[model samples]
Target: QPALCPKGHYCPNGTRFATQFGCPEGTLSNGVGLQDASECELCPLGHYCTGVGIHGAPRGPCSAGYYCLRGATTRTPNDNVTGGICPAGHYCPAGTSEPIDCPNGTFSAATGATDVAACQACVAGRACPTTGRTAPGAPCSAGFYSPLGSA
Candidate 1:
């Protein structure tokens, strides 16, 4: 007798065993007897699916300091995880699928900053020369002055 395959798994016709094939990574199945790979749904947005045989849910949410789009296979893509590091001059809040650029007149020195608050305002007398500045750039080029938050 043939039985329905379990969630996260698929059994093709003439299959001898239900677990003969597990759904590939980046996808999940919530119901039993998934017959084809297409039955496995892509991991939902803001989530990552890193493990094999994921049945009821994705491996987990994309970790902090990172973002995951739909079907993300890892937490952060920059050697540490999967979805790709929040680039310089940008911040990524929790569950963010994309990095948000720091507003003008602000800058971030770090790459994994998690919030807009991480983008520091240009200090008094210093000019943030660019959109994504690691440090308040050259000191107003001597003589010329800038107020706080100057870009």
Candidate 2:
């Protein structure tokens, strides 16, 4: 006899009811009828599996512009617990494990940016602002001119 295995549980070929193995805190099971413990899959970056013996279909995807680290199984929306924001000075697309720094002449002023559009270009006449997360830095002081992206 076979039963439905939840996302956080591992059901072997002959697993009994409720006796299934736990997928641990950082892993999960996406489907049912798992024949081996190997079926337990790692929760990819930007994704989570909070409950036990659950399915990935309902609780997956760590939200756009946010990266979910490996072995992570919980929703951490800007809370910095289960997950974290994209952060300033960088752009983070959906389902990313890390953020990419804004290239020279470009800057990002907000967190959780889903695309490069979040990065703004520095004015050619103004000195690049030393500030992070904010693009288009303040204009150079009187008489102090600067080329594009000048720091």
Best by TM-score: 1
- What is the per-residue lDDT of model 1 for residues 18-122, given as tens digits with 9 covering 90 to 100? 778888888888889888988888888678888767887777777777877777888775643347777778888777777788877888888888889999998
**Compared with the true structure, what per-residue lDDT tens digits does model 2 show for residues 1-151?**
4457665577666667754577666666766656666677766667766655554552666666776776556555555655677888877776667777776667777888877877787777765545444666666778778786666
> Candidate 2 overall Cα lDDT vs. reference?
0.67
Candidate models: Cα lDDT each: 0.79, 0.67
Badly placed stretches (over 4 Å) of model 1 are: 79-82, 123-145
Cα shift from native, residue 98, model 2 (Å): 0.6
User: Highest lDDT, which number?
Assistant: 1
**Model 1 steric clash pairs:** 76-81, 76-82, 76-83, 77-82, 77-83, 77-84
Q: How does residue 91 of candidate 2 score in lDDT?
A: 73
Clash count per candidate:
6, 11
Residue 123 of candidate 1: its Cα lDDT?
88
